[model samples]
Target: MPANLTPQYHKAEEVYKQAKTSEEKIAALEEMLRAMPKHKGTDHLQADLKRRIAKLREEESRPKSKKAAFDPFRVEKGGAGQVLLLGAPNAGKSAIVARLTSAPTQPTPFPFATQGPIPGMMAHEDVQVQLVDLPPITPDYFPSGMLGLVKSADGALLVADLSSDLVLDDLETILAKVSEGRVRLFDPAVQTAGAPADSDEVLLVRIPALLLANKGDADGAQDRLELLRELYQGRFDPLVISAETQEGLDRLPGAVFGMLKRIRIYSKEPGKPVDRSSPFVLKEGDTVLDLAARIHRDFPEHLKQARVWGSARFEGQAVQRDYVLRDRDVVELQVDL
Candidate 1:
């Protein structure tokens, strides 16, 4: 089968050619990869693109000449997962971060108060989720490394200021800017809505997004939110919040955790009690074997049967390696000496 490349892929290729910086080139290449039709015909091309991308990333990570010294975008991901706070200028992105985490935020009435990416840990029950407050994105101005950061995040919270009548326009502008990089935002209901139902030829990064209508305490905020709901018509389930008032802020962490779609698994030694404080996080529907492999490199090859505690039919019940693990499940692996 011939590789039926789309117009979007060709556009990305053009951008890649015109890119002046390594980061810009990488972003364009990634956009190309996302836009390319995934088929056997493009498998080799995909592999080659991936190889080039890896090489570029490796080159960028290494120390270069004295002129290229600092890299501000290199954020080490921590906690359960990283969630990006994204929106147009002064959409309350900084305010939201300040309310949720201890990270110092410059939340003023002025736009573009945040000039760099700021990561903060938001506690969700026993675990912590990394939330990065990114510079506001707009059609005229998007930070060079913003796309990469958004693409690498587990999920995103698209904030809109309910106090302003331009809220809907701001939301649309943000979406358009992201889409130009081949990234699409959708809720669970419209996950597959962007692609054609009959074909698998589409290439797009469909990110799970939560619409946050901030400044809920503002005058006429309720009317704005109602209009927003009517405008989107269930496409985006907007979460009304007041970062200053702390109203609806408590539920933000839980909503972010749910968007991550990850499960927590506790591990135990032969005779020791399960360490409940720290959990080995895995994507939902992962198997016991996956947890074993994560625990140790040799566990998968030299392991025997395993016993389960939480989410098991019985306490300490023996389970095979293929047993599907559940959230908060405690696993005790018995490996052969």
Candidate 2:
């Protein structure tokens, strides 16, 4: 099938040509992917774009010289999903991560206290999600590799200081900077549906983001949050929290999990009990065949039938290979060895 590429994709291609940094190139490629039509005709093109994005990300995450400073931006993804904490200087991004995860953090009063990305795992009920606290994104000081890190994240928490009068402006600056790099923040209203299958116009990389209004206990903080909602209600929703006092922090893990849009599936042996402690994490809409393939590369082909414990009509109910699995579903694949 011929890829009937659109004008938007070609325009992004031109931007890719003019891009000076890897971050800008990645943004352009992501835009191209978003603008390209989602169909069999463009499968090869889409695959190529994705490959290029991955290659660029890998290269950017590596260190350039042995004598150069340690690449603090390089973070290996772990757990159910990877989320990045993004905000202006002294916006409490590191404080939030330190409070939520076991990662060592120095929460100083000075701006730019965090010069590199520090990763920690946030526990949510039975599963854990990886959270990386990154350097502040200021007008004059943003790491050239920041966009690559942002593109690798499954979601983002846009932290802002509710006590500061410049909070709104700070948020706007972060948004504008990221947009200029081609990584558009996700807005549910504007991106309610995916691009039309027949249409060649691609959409930009719209990452689901939650605005964190930190220092909520400070004076006039509530008013700042109100103003923020008033000005950017349609663009993003703000979650008020105080990392210092740990107020409203209890709900943050669940919120991050919800934004990840992932499902957990537990595996069980044919005659053994299910291992509920560790789960195989997969995106939503995964099937039994997909689970089988995850278990073993040959399981998908040698599979006969499977028994599902959760989201089934009955416990241990026999299901076909194509049975769609749900979150926390216990699966037992009876494959022909």
Candidate 3:
């Protein structure tokens, strides 16, 4: 069973990483375990994967039915991308959501605030991304059904209260609850780990998070902020801001948008040319065939070749659908006419 073990494991892990929800991750892990070979070397690995899977399942079922049912949640469908915000109590998650998007969010100062997910639409340079604000979670808090929501996010912003000396404690507590290992930041150069085995869920969380230290305007907050960043050892790109006065708020949108690895490309159709003003935003790794598939699955199947007439070159250069497309590049599909 050593045949193709490496590649098979890799692909499964990739899928698990891309999975947006805990349910999806769990399903992927089960399959990985099934595909993996049973041997002495893999025994420990298998056991660890199974234990993690069980923990996810157990945490998913921790809350009561009434409490779970009462969780206010919304999943926004239309957007270039989506980001979920994570933080502890009074961390200004709701305020940031309200400041960035056109969502009517309630900003309160109580513990266990925002008992559910609130969806908001954020627009940037004609592109729109959805943001979700989830309920505050402490070190010991693992509310039922919240894991799935966090897993679904394209990216996550870890918010902290810089004005308070306990900001570092907050980060450690929150990270302990939701994260595992180094989260991938969608870097094209760095390859992912070995493929996943059956029953092992890959959490492809985009990391190098945008760390926000709220209450920047408060006295002595700046010094505390520096100390926190140094303590993290550049693990996070820290931004000091006051959600109330909107200080440093302008940069938050950019940070969120930048995390999205997607780029826009226009398609020059055979008969009807694609619109450049409103192009589709796709992840960086997507190839011309990927775009074709997005436009129509059959496009890739029947796609004989394609032509490019943008950034990569001048005029139109005929090419294959597998050609990797770049940001702002214009492509023309040569299909059966």
Candidate 4:
């Protein structure tokens, strides 16, 4: 029997061939399985893929040696969401990250000062968003496993150096490289209308991205901004900011948090005051039942109703399990004992 595969499966196979890490391989294999024709002819192939998946998962679970090789690309996710800081050499990614998170970034008057991924926590109101300063990417300096990291991230912040004349060239290269990796950068407003119909040739990981035109305080920065607008022309309306002067940064934390499409909820006891310090971050459209489940594994089984504070018709109004949550909504769960 001939195993006639679809174009999507072939595309995934190419990705699998190029995969450098177990995570990337597993992702590709899963895609392949999803796109493969479900017929007796593909039975052997299906079993083979399953076996490969199991093997990769086992390898992932296996403990690493203390003396094992360090993976500069691997960054374990932390905080509410992980956002990657991508840019060309000396594009001021490190400086912006330092300003946002107060993390140490030893700035040198040189390119490639950052050697690997530097993870920092940027506080957005009550929640912390992880901003990773990835090593500078250029046509000649794209590190291995970079795309995998980008694909795994919640969002991205691409910084462009307004102080440099060759900023456009660098930006062009950065965009091209990510596109080749099948990662599409959306401005958050775009692509939320509806996901692209799943196609055989396209399996893009669409991410909400914001372009920051750095060094807005520098001379000729405004001219450079105009040029960028003309060059990319409607494709990007870059956010202007000065990492050195901290101008136009008052809304940056909120902007990044908005990209995650997340809402912070305050869980409360029936008679106790809500703890506004630490919020239970939930998806923007998550329900009261979702919050109950997050509170405890067995909560949904006993969930009866909830009292709302923020989005209720009136204060302390009793809502059903399916009531949608809004940001900062104080939810008092009433689960049967």
Candidate 5:
């Protein structure tokens, strides 16, 4: 196991080491799931463990005792980016997922029908974002732990009904629940919506938001759209879309990617792009020195200086890594190399 996985391995070992029976072994496996890293490398190991754990647990619990109706819907992380979709019932979330990714989803008319999170993905150029359509939230079934997942997502898409008054109430309920990220309506004409041009109200969290008014083909949609726009005081660009027809799905990925910030810069060494796809994603104004520290502790201390060869300060300008890097600024390090 890699050093990064050591902690989890040790945890699992400790849990299983003292287990004397199948039941205890099953409990240990559950702990491993909580601790193990979820990635390609661990896929097989995870699957085997889950199988063993399930078999053991199945034997332990008789049909009557088994409370595990089994939420077969486990949250599988997709793509490098994650965009969580939230809304009330009948918000066309499943349609959005069906149109965007190849994931198989059952689209139907019902509230809270999606018992758990459904993850799908779409690519924007070379980058891909996983969109998770979670169970619909109504005043009756607003679970606390489920809300936490939305708070940590990279971005959020809030769906609404353009033809109904129920949307307003849903919006208010959602606003009350979000602990992180700002809320902004999306524009039907545009994909990525900005804060109102006139208002100086700074978004509480710069986390991107998409306000989608679904059922564009329905009657009174335009009237509802205008009403929603006024309700938000045009702070957000409200998007009127018909997910049923897959309208505006092409722009969906772009809108998501636009909200995400990423810029590639070359490394100090020849033939090295700083691997923008590395586990650590940084923003502008972060220094190459900062990246060095993140990559490894020794690299930062041994670092001498850096040379550049991209758009930051014109080509081939040698500068110290402390010199904050701008987006697309190539950095060649003069470290132990």
Candidate 6:
């Protein structure tokens, strides 16, 4: 049989060829692999693509040289997923981080309190999500470093200061500046496509984001928030929250976790008790093979069947390599002897 490829694959291949960064190349290659037809004719090609992907991934993860000048903006990702808190000064990004996690992001009565990126783990039940309280954005002084952070994050909270009448103006300022930096923010639930990509000087990233109307506890804040929503109707769906009084905060962690679009899986040795403490975080719709890949790069190619405790018809049911996993699922892998 002849190997068939899709237009999507061809398009992604072109993207890979023109990619200037390892991250972009990897993304394009992954898209190509997903679009390519699988058959005996494509077996060798599949293996070749896999080898190339593995090599690029290794290069991407390799530690940087110690002698190189340190970049203050670069933050190492941690926890279930990395989320960026973006907004204007005194938008309560710091307050949100302080209340959610004990990150010491001292929120003062004034603006620009958070001068740098502070990564803190916010726990919800068993899993922890990483939230980075980044420097504020303003009309004249938005941090250039923050655009890069937003592009790399899994999600973002575009916080709006409800206490200020110029909340809509702040939103416009944030959007305009970020767009100039080749980054676009959109609620995945609101819109599908984004503006066209820019030149190779920067890679354009469209991040899934939620608008947060912070400081809702303030007087006349609700009226201002209503106007803010009306002005940006269908553009951004804002979530009303009061960081100081903890109002609507009870829903925050869960909302953050939901925005991440991730699921946690627990791994177990055959005939051994399941270890639920350290769950392996995986993207939603990930399969058993993905979990195997996460465990070890070689495990995906190495042999065999897997058993599932959760998201199964019955407990401890045997599943195939491509078995789609669910949140909090327990998995046991059996390899060739």
Scored by TM-score, the top model is 6
Pull out the clashing pairs in model 6: none
TM-score of each: 0.78, 0.80, 0.74, 0.79, 0.63, 0.87
Look at candidate 6 and tell me the lDDT of residue 136: 83
Clashes of 3: 8
Collision count of model 6:
0
Cα lDDT of model 6 by residue, 1-337, tens digit: 7788876667777878999888777666766676678665765676578778779967755677999766666778888888889889888898899999988789888888788899899998789988899888888887656766766677888999988878888989998998897677887667753433433322456677888889888989989988987887877778899998999999988887877778989999987899988999998877787788788878878748899998999999999876789999999998764
TM-score between model 3 and native:
0.74
Candidate 5 lDDT over residue span 66-87, tens digit each = 6655433335455656777888
Evaluate model 5: give its TM-score.
Answer: 0.63
Whole-model lDDT values for every prediction: 0.81, 0.82, 0.69, 0.82, 0.63, 0.81
| Residue pairs clashing, model 4 | none
Candidate 1 at 258: error in angstroms?
Answer: 0.5
Give a tens-digit lDDT track for model 2, residues 1-337.
Answer: 7788988788888878877878668867977887787665775576578668878978976767888866556688899988999999899999999999999888999988888889999999889999999889988877757876776678899998998999988988899888776566764432442443322223245577888889999999989989988987667778889999999999999888877778999999989989988899886766787688667868877888899998999999999775779999999988898
Tens-digit lDDT track of model 1 for 221-336: 99999998998776788889998898999999988888788899999998998899889998776678778777876787777889999888999999877688999999999998
Candidate 4 matches the true fold with a TM-score of: 0.79
Residue 60, model 4, lDDT: 74
Question: Scored by Cα lDDT, where does model 6 land?
Answer: 0.81
Error of 2 at 290 (Å): 2.3
- State the lDDT at 113 in candidate 5: 72
TM-score comparison, 3 vs 4, better candidate: 4
Per-residue C-alpha lDDT of model 4 across residues 264-335, encoded as one tens digit per residue:
999888889898989998877667876886788689778877999989999899997768899999999988
